[model samples]
Target chain A: MTQLAADIASTFTAEGAEPFTVDATLEAGDEETLVILGPSGSGKTLLLETVAGFHGHDGTVTVNGTDIADRAPERRDFGFVFQDYALFPHMTVRDNVRYGAQYCENPRDAEGLLAELGVAHLADRTPPTLSGGEKQRVALARALAVRPDVLLLDEPLAALDVPTRQSLRDDLVDVLADVTSIYVTHNRTTARAIADRIIVMAQGQVVQRGTPDAVFERPESPIVANFTGSNVIELASTPAVRSLLDGDTPGRGDAHGNGTAERVAIRPEAVRLDDDNGDLRATVRRVVREDATHRVTLAFDEVTVESFTDSPPEVGTDVVITLPRDRLHPC
Target chain B: MATETGSGLDVKTGRVQTAVLVAGFVGVQLLAFVAAYATGRPTWYAYFMIGSAAVTAYLLDGSSFVVATATLGSVLLIALGLPLFMFVARQTPSLVVEKAADPDVHRVLYLGIYGPLLAAILSLAFGVPLAHLLSEGFSGQPLVESLVDLPLVVPHSVAGILVLFGFGEGGAFPSISVLGSMVGMVLAMAFVAAPYAVNATREAFEAIDHRLEYASRIHGANRWETFRRVTGPLAVRGMITGGVLAWARAVSEFGAVAVVAYSVSFFYPFAGGEVTAQHAPVFVYNTYLQGGLQESGAVAFLLLAVSAMIFLIVRYLTDDNTIGGVP
Candidate 1:
C-alpha cells in the first residue's frame, strides 16, 4: 500500500548563483525505507526539504490519498533530521528529545527513546559536549519522540568518521525496519545498505529507480555507473567488446539514430590479475593498500582500469589480466 | 595541542607581525598626541584620536589581529582615561563626601541614574524588534539599517531639537510637553543611544544558524514559538551587552538632555528649599558656573565613582551563562 506520494517541481535560486530545478515524482510504501541517491548539487536535499514543506514549490503531496500540499511546515507531521544534526546546544539531550511533545498528540517517553537509540547515558549532557556519533543518536531519538509519520533524513551520517558512520548506518538498518522514510545521501553504499527501493538523481531529475541489486548490477547509463563506483572504459579497439557491441553499444553508437552504448562499466573486483591463460596483458601502474586488499591500477595500453587483489605484484611488472565476460555490463 | 620545539612551539602563529604592528600603531598615536599639543587643538585632537583609533582597530584584518588590536587600542583608551583618572585622584575625599551628603546633590544623582535606566529600557523595548526585522532582510534593507543608525550620527543637540519638534506642544502634538520633564530627558537620551542596542542585537541575530529555527518549525513549532524558545536565548548575551552600552551612552549624555531639560523641576515639594534637580552633567556645569571648578570637580568625582561601580557590577552579572548555538 502507498504510504505517501509527492509530485514536486521547484527552482532553487540563490544569490550570485544560477538557478536549478528539482522536479520528481515519488512514492513510498508502508513500512518501507526509500533512499534517494545522488551526487553533490543534484538537489536531493532540496527535494526532501520541499516535500517536508520547508520551501514553497509546485507539487501535490498526499498521505494515504489525502491532499496536504498547502499545509504549513509545522502541520506536516514530518520529522526532519538536518545534516549538521541541528541539536540545541543549550538544552540537555533529554529536553531536546522531549521538546516536540508539547505539539504532538502522542509522544514516546524521551528517556525510553534515548535508551532505545543507545544514548540514555548522555541524557543530561548538552549537544556541544557530545561526540558526533552521540549527537546523531540524540537527533534520531528526538525525531522519533513525536512518532512522526515519515522521517526525512538529510545525510545524517555524512559528518561522522568512518567507524561511527558504519556503526550508525548499521543501527539505522534496524531502526528503520518498520518506519516509512526517505533518506537522501551522496554515498551509494549507505543507499544500498538501507534502501527498499533506490532513486538515482542527476541534475535535479530522477534518472533511474530500482532495488539495490538491480540498480547496482545493471545500471542503464554512464552517469549511474560512474556514480556507483563502476570503472566505465571506452571500447574503441578492445577485441573483448566486439561481440557485446553488436546491438548493445555502451558509447558512441552509429548515427542511424542508434543510442550511444560503446562504453562498458566494469567493476574493479572483476578485473583479475596473474591469470596465466588470460587473453589481455597489462602493466601495473600503482598499488595502494585498502582495508583487506590492494587496489591495483592496471594500464591496458591507453585505458587505465582498477582491480582489487589480495596479493598484488610490484609496480613496473608486466602482468596478465582477464576481463571475465559475465562481469562486463554495457551501461 | 602544541608541542614545544627548541626554537618554537608546534603551533604556527604571527607573533612577530603582531608585535611590529602594535608597536607601529602606538608610535603613530603618540606622534598624533604631540602634534595635537603643538597645534593647540588639544580637545579636538583628543576626540579625533579616540574615534580614529576605534575605527582603525575595527578595520585591522588578517590573522594575529586580536592581540594586535587590543595592544593598539589600549593606547587611546589610556590616553583619554588618564585625565579622568587624575581628575578623580586629585579631588579631596572629605569634600566629595560632604557634597554627597547634600539632599540637592542626592536629587541630581537620582535623576541622572534613573533617566539613563529608563532610556536603556526604552531602547531595548523598541530596538530589539527593529533589529529582528532588519536581520530578516527585505527591499530597502540598507536604508532601514542606516535609519536605525541615524540617532548615532546626528548632533546630540540636533537630536534634541528633532525630538522636541516631533513630540513637543504646537509641533506634532499640542497637548504634549516634552520639555523640562523626566520623560523629556529619557526621550533625549534614547534618541542618541538607540543605535548601539539595534546594531548589537542585529549582529547577534545574524550570527545564529537559521537551521536551528527550521528544525524547530518542522518539529511542530510555529514561527513565534521557535523565535521565543530558540532565537531569544541564543542572542541574549548580545542584547544585554547592547543595553549596557546604551545605558552608558545615555548616562554620559549632556547636550541633548540639557536641551530638553537644563534643570528638571520635581512635581511635589521636597524636604529642602530647592525644588528642582539637574542631571549629573548639567549639575556639574551649573556648579562650575556658580562656584568654579573646585566645587563641581568634587561632585563630578562622586558621580564617576558611583557610575564605575555600577558598570562593573553589571559587567560581572552578564559575564557568564552564555546559551544556544549549533555545535
Candidate 2:
C-alpha cells in the first residue's frame, strides 16, 4: 500500500523575478525509503517543501488514505528535516527532540531516541555548540520522536565535511531501515546507498523513476544518463562507435543501430584502456588523479569516453580504448 | 617578500603584529588619561593623539590596509567622544551635587525620565504589531517602510509642527485637547521615537530563520503557539533593546516637546511648580536663555549622568542571549 502519495504543483515566485514551477507526482510504499535525486535548483527541495505543505500548491496530498491537501503544515503529520538542520538554537538537544513529542499521542521517548542515534551525551547542549555530524543526528532523532507518518528530509548530510558525511550516511542506513521516508539529494552515491526506490528530477520535472539499479544501469534519457555519471555518445554523430555495442545491453535501436535511440551510455568503470588490440583506436585526452585510481579521458573521432585505470597513459598519447558491448546501454 | 595574507601572517610577522597591537592599546589609554586628567597644554596632547593614531595603525599590522582602517576608526571614535568626555571630565563633583539638590532641577528630571518612559511604553504597544506585520511582508513593502522611517529624516521642528497639526484642539481630534498636557508630550516623543522600535524589532524578526518557524509548525504548534513559544521568545530581547533606544531618543528630544507641551501641568501643584517645570532638555534651554553657558552646562551634566546610568543598566539586563543560527 502507498504510505504517502503526493501530487504537487507549485510556482516558486520571487519579487521582480521569473517564476519556476515544480510539478511532480510520486508515492512511497509502507516502510520504504523513496529518494529524490537532482542537482541544485532542480526543484527537488521546492517539490519536497510543497508536499510538506510549506508552500501553496494546486494538487492533492494524502497519507494513509487521509486527504491532507487543505491542512496547514502545523496540522499535517509529516516530519521535515531541513538541509541545514533547523533545530531551534534556543532549545537544548533533549528539548528539541521532545518538541514534536508534545503534539503526539504515542511519541517515542526523547532520551531513548537520542541514545539510538548516538547523541544522548549531547542532549543538554544547544544546536550551535554541536559539531555538524552531532547536529544532524540530533535533527534525525527530533524528526523521529513524533513517529510521523512520513519523514521528509532535504539533503540533511550535505552541509557536513566529507568524512563526516560518509560516517553519518552509514548511520543513516540503519536509522532509515524501516521508516517511510522521502529523502532528496544530488549525490548519486548517497541515493544508491540509502534508497529503496529513486526518482531523478531536472528543471522541476521527474525524468526517471525506478529501483536504483534500473535507473543507474538503464537510463532511458540522455539527461538521466549524464546526470548519473555515465558518458553519453550520440550514435548518429559517431557512426563508427555503433558496431562496438553489437551485443550490448537491450537497446531501442534495431540490429543496424539505426533506430529510435539517439544516444548510448557507458559507465567509466566498464570502459577499458588497452595499449594495443583494442576495438577502437583512440588518443588519451586527459588524466585526472582520483582516490585509489586515475580517471583517463579517451577520444576516438568525435566520441569521448572516460575510463578508470590503475596506471594511466600520458595525455596526447596514442591508445586503444575498448568499449564492452554488454556495458553500452541505449538512451 | 612581504606577503598580504589578511591576518594569516607567517610566525615572525604574526608575533610582531600582536606585540604592536598590544602596545598600541596601552598607548591609547595613556592618551585618554592625558586628555581627561591633565587638561592643560591641550595643543600638545592634540598633536600626540594624531601622531599616535597614525603610527599605531601602521605598526599594528604590516598591511597598509590595516593602517588605513585602524586610523579611520580611531579618528571617528575620538571625534564622537571628545566633546562628551570633555564636558563630563571638566565638571566638579560639588557643583553637580549642587545642581541635583535644586528643586527646579529635580521636577524637570523626574518629568524628563518618566515622560520618555511612558513614550517608550506607548511606542512598544503600537510599534511591535506593525513590525510583525512588516516582517511577514507584502507588496509595496518598501513604501510602507519609507513611511515608517519618515520621522528619522524629518527635521525635528517640522516633526513638532506636524504633531501639533495632527493632535491639537482644532486639528484631527477636537474633542481631546493635547495642547499642553503630558499626553501631548508623549505623542510628539513617540512620533519621532516609534521608528527605532519598529525597525529594530523588524530586523530581529527577520533575523530568525523561517525554517525554524516551519519546524515549530510541523511539530504541531499552531500559528499563535509557534509565535508565543518560539518566535516571540526569540525576538523579545530585540524588542526590549529597541524600546530602550526609543527611550534614549525620546529623553534627549527637545524641539517637538517644546512645541507640543513646553511644561506639563498633570504633575503640577504636587511639586514646587511656580510656573510649571518642563522636561530636562527644555529646562536646559530655558536655563541657557535665562542664565549663561555655565549654569546650563551644570544642569546638562546632571541629566547626562542619570541618562547614562539608566541606559547602561537596561543594556546590561537585555544583553546577548542571541538565537544562534546553524553555522
Candidate 3:
C-alpha cells in the first residue's frame, strides 16, 4: 500500500443537503495524478473541499494515516487553489505567498520560493493589476509556498483563455511534479493531458477510477464514456472499441500505463478514410472542418460512426471506413 | 485621452461666441440696474436683484449664461458696493442677527449638533457665576420659566445649579465646588456635551466593516490590537465629529449656567466672580427691556458673530467623505 496523505471515508451531509458518500484510499506511491471529473452539481467540489477541511461534513479524512477528522483548514496542511484564484485582493503578490508562510514554523525560504515562482519582480503588484496568467501563477505559488502535504486544485485553469490555459497546464504539470495533488476539472482535454489516473464522478459517487487510458478506453458507465468523449456502443460478439478480456489484470496490476483494457478505444483520428471498396462502408451524413482537421460522420444501418480525416467524401457519397480488429474492444 | 469634439464647433469661434454671450448677459443686467436706479428703487436692492438674476441664469444655462449675467451683475454690485460702503462708514457696529430674528445660538446648536463645544468652554469660563446662581438660587425666579422657552428641552441653568450644589458647599461633591468656580461649569458643560461624542463615536464604529476586523483577527491580532489597528483608524472621523459636536454643545450652554451661577458684577460678567445667575443672555435680555435698544442690539450682534463662527467650524470639520474606504 502506498502512503497516502489524505484518506476519505463515510458520508458528508449538510443541512438540506443530500448525503455525499465516497470511500477511496489514495497512497503516496500513486504518484499517478488523480483527476476528479464530473458535471456541475456532481459534488466534485464538495468532495475536494471536504478533504481540504473547508466543508463541515461528516467524514473521516486522514492525512498521512493520521485522522484529521476535526482539524481546521489552516491546520490540515493542504494547499487549495479555488476556481477564481481567491487571491486576497488587498495583498500584493509577495504578501499572498507570505500569507501561508505564517503557518510554517520557519519562513526563511519564502523569498527564495517567490523568486523560484518567477514572481519576485511582481512582488508589489496587487492581484487586480496583474494579468490573468500572472494572477494564476501567483495563486499557484501561494498554494505551493506552504509545501502542503496534499494539494487540492478546483478547476484552476477554467478561468483562462485557451492559449493561456494550455501554457499554464504545462506549467502546472512541472510545478506539481512532486506534490500529491487532487486535480478537479470539467474539461476532458485537461483531464486527458494531466491526469495519470482519472476518477469519473456522477451525482456524488466515483463511477470509475484508473489510468486515463483505462477509464477513457473502457468506461464502465455511459456517463463516464460520454464525459470522456468516447463512443460508447452496445454490441454482442465483439465490442466496437477495445476492451480487456476476462481474468486479465490491468497492465499486470500496474494501473498507470499499459493497463489491460476491456474495451477498445479507436480514437476519432484512428479511423482512416478508404474510398476504394472496403468491408465497412456507409453513406456520408455530414462533413465538418473542425479546427485543423475534418470530422466525417458515416451512417450505417444501426449505428452512426464518426471519423476524422484530412479529405472528406461528399455529403451523399458512400464512403468506406474500417475499425481494425486490434482497436475493436469487448466489454 | 478621448477629447470631446464638442459638436465640431470651431475653437476660434467659441471665443467669439463666449464674448457675445457674456456681452448679452451683461447688457441685460446693466439694463436692469439702470432701471432700478432710474426708478428710484433702494440702491442695495439693485445688487440683490442683479445678483439673484445672475445666479438664476448661470444655474440654468451653465457657463455661457453665467458669464453673460455676471458681466451685467458686476456693474450692479459696484454701484451697490459704493453706497453700502458709505452706509457702513456712518453706522455703529451691531449684532449681525437680531433678537427680532430670534437668533438662539443654543437652539441652532442643539438642532444641528453644532455649538456644544463652545457652550462647554463658556461654561468653564463662567463657572464662578454658575456656582453663585446655584448657591443663591434664582432671585428673579425666571430660570424655571426660561427653561421651557430655551432652545433645547433641558434647562441649562438648572443643569448648572445641580453641578454647583453637587460640587459646591453643603454640596454632595465634597472636595469640588464649581459653586462659584470654573471647574463646576466645565463639569456641567461636559455632562451636556458628552452625548454627542458618545453617539457619534458609536455611529462611527458601526460604519466600519466587520470583515476587516475578521481579517485582522485571522492574521493573529488580538481584540485590542485589531481594534487599535483597524477599527480605530476607521472610526476616527466619527470620533472627531462627535467630539466637536460635544464640545460645541458644552460651550454654547447658558440657561443652566445662568440659573446656577451669576456674575459678581454685571459690567465684566466674564471675570471669575462677575458671572452670576444674571448671565450674558439674561443681561442682554434685561438690557433690551430696561436699557436702550442700542446696548441690546450690540450684545445680540456679539452673540450672533460668535455663534456663526462656531457653526462654520463644525460644518467644515464634519463634512461628508470623512471616512476613507477600507478595501
Expressed as tens digits, the lDDT of each residue in A17-69 for candidate 2 is 68998999989999799999999989999989888888899988988878899
Quality class of the docking in candidate 1, CAPRI style: medium
User: CA lDDT of each candidate?
Assistant: 0.83, 0.85, 0.61
TM-score of each: 0.84, 0.87, 0.54
TM-score for chain A, candidates 1 onward in order: 0.92, 0.93, 0.82
Error of 1 at B188 (Å): 2.1
DockQ of every candidate: 0.53, 0.43, 0.05
Q: After superposition, how far is residue A140 of candidate 3 from its true place, in Å?
A: 0.6
Off by over 4 Å in 1: A237-240, A243-260, A274-279, A324-327, B1-77, B170-175, B265-276, B321-327
The per-residue C-alpha lDDT of model 1 at residue A44 equals 95
Report how far off residue B125 is in candidate 2 (Å): 3.0
lDDT of candidate 3 over A56-81, digit per residue (tens): 55547775567876876656666777
Model 1 agreement with the true structure over A113-140: per-residue lDDT tens digits? 9988888999999998899999999999
Model 2 misplaced regions, further than 4 Å? A15-17, A245-259, A272-279, A287-289, A309-326, B1-44, B62-79, B89-94, B170-175, B266-276, B321-327
| DockQ ranking, high to low | 1, 2, 3
Model 2 Cα lDDT, one tens digit per residue, B210-254: 898988988778888888777878788878878998999999999
Query: Largest lDDT belongs to which candidate?
Result: 2
